[model samples]
Target: MLKKPTSAYVHIPFCTQICYYCDFSKVFIKNQPVDDYLEALIREIKAYEIRDLRTLYIGGGTPTAITARQLDYLLSHLTEQINLDMLEEFTIEANPGDLTEDKIAVLKDSAVNRVSLGVQTFNDRHLKQIGRSHNEAQIYSTIDSLKTAGFHNISIDLIYALPRQTMADVEENVKKALALDIPHLSLYSLILEHHTVFMNKMRRGKLNLPTEDLEAEMFEYIIQQMEANGFEHYEISNFTKPGFESRHNLMYWDNDEYFGCGAGASGYINGMRYRNRGPIQHYLKAIRETNHARLSEEVLTKNEQMEEEFFLGLRKKSGVSVKRFEQKFGLSFDDQYGQVVKELRAEGLLSEDKDFIRMTKKGLFLGDTVAEKFILG
Candidate 1:
């Protein structure tokens, strides 16, 4: 039997404005059916048997874009289903400008204990260039507001290697981030996803991103700076103080199943991974008609499962546990990937200790390359 998921992800696909690099299922919250969408989202959540959840992450295009009343309604209905006291962490992603005092108060009244702000850069120029609505001032104000409201378990995201971003820019961004004294940080390199404005600009030679070596240097700089600031590099792109690591994200890196609710949300349950409809109308229609909005589902084979375990588990700083792998698959980790591991080790990408096999710093940079070696097919 598949283990019951203790974590859940809710997607809010509305944003005040779309960023140039974002490709997530999101729409401008102008004339959209916000009330209908919220009702449909609740309907979809009710379809599942309500149980105590360990982590509840409400991510988005921007969850904070909704009005205070809307946020209260959403959280109230959510807590009714998933017992609030049982949640180890309840996170809501917010954009700096969108997080008004009223909305923060709504969050304060709810079970939310963590707030992750998408403060992609501290440079107002870069922020504007990237199509972000908020400026540096707003980011500081939002952080201040969140802290004043007794929300200390706060995290912020920073993106490096943006178009025309320099080493100086990255340093400035890091310095500003560290000064915030936040508990957690998620630093990511810019990835030009298909359908994003950045990608279109790149095709037209209009976007000048950092070179691979410079990008790697920026990554290295972030790791060093975060470590110096007393943050642990718990995951590839995540850093945290000792106990402030995001438990909700840890659920994903651990390859644990989770319920994914809302438009375009993805969930893993009963050994099957499924995605909900992306279009708001379609999602609403599905939820209204069938009480579920699943668009597609895929059941993994044994080989697929093993590959996922390796790839996902290795993303953690602790790497994959030999005992856990053997117990789960009833096969020796060495027997299955002995040659691959040996090669990676010889290349100085992997190292094995008593119970865990982990990636080295060099391997972490080439993470995708290392992970792809484990694909069975």
Candidate 2:
């Protein structure tokens, strides 16, 4: 039997306002069946057998956008399905402006120990350009409130290489982020996905993103600045203080299965990866009819699983373990990936010790290219 997933990811697809770059399954929080959706969400959670969960992540479209009473209902029901004591990390994604004192109090009373705020950037102009509703002041106030609420394990996300953004802007953003002294930070380069406003602008030659070289410079600068400030570059886009790394995300990079609940959520269970229907009405209807909302499910083949192990594991600073890969796949890691590994290492993109094969510093910049080589014929 496949091992039960010890992690769960709950998606709350409601947003007060959507960002220009976001393409996640989300809807505005007006004229929707909010209460009924919560009921269906809880019912879906109850459909699974209750067990101890090591990590639970409540991600967005902005979980904090709802009223405190609604949040209370969601969290209370969530706790009923999993024992709180066994939960080492309980995280909730929030918007800085949406985290009212009442909402913070609700989180404080619950088992939520970590909060990932969508700060995006400290530049107000960029914030407005990106359709983020929160300003720099709201970010500071929100962090202060979270600190007052006894939430020390806080993290904020920053976006670099934005439209018309300069290196100086990134420097300013990083300076402000460091000044906050938050325990963890995630910095991502801007990606233009299909159907996003930014992507349409780019297609029309209306968006002026930085050149590839400048973007690389910004990334390097971020890594350097973060390291100077005592933050560990644990993943490609993630930095953390000692013992403050995101355990929930680590479960993903480790390629472990997890329960993905709520509308538009994706889960991996029993060697199968599945996603729920993105539309709220569709998800609710499916859940009410069958107690599950899976829109599609695929059981990974052995080769696919092996490829995933390398793709996900290589994102970490420690890289992929040769022993673990061999033990899991019942094949020698060298025998399976010997040629690919030799080519990457020859190009100075990978290095291997006895236990692990990891990316070199240069390999970090070309992570996707390196990871793609691990695929079998």
lDDT score of model 2? Answer: 0.93
TM per prediction: 0.99, 0.99
Q: 245, model 1: CA deviation in Å?
A: 0.7
Residue 197 local lDDT, model 2: 94
lDDT of 1 at 168: 96
Candidate 1 per-residue C-alpha lDDT over 1-377 given as tens digits, one digit per residue, 9 for 90 to 100:
54678899999999999999999999999999999999998888888875779999999989999999999999999998987678899999999989999999999999999999999999999999999999999999999999999999999999999999999999999999999989999999998999999999999999999999999999999999999889999999999999999999988978888999999999999889999999999998999899999999999898998888878988899998889889988997878998999999999999999999889999999998999899998
Off by over 4 Å in 1: none
Model 2 C-alpha lDDT per residue in residues 1-377, reported as the tens digit of each score: 65788999999999999899999989999888889989998888889764689999999788998899999999998998888779999999999999999999999999899999999999999999999888999999999999998999999999999999999999999999999989999999999999999999999999999999999999999999999989999999999999999999999999989999989999999889999999999999999899999999999999999999989999999899898888888998778999889999999999999899999999999988899998886
lDDT of 1: 0.93
Note the Cα lDDT for every prediction shown.
0.93, 0.93
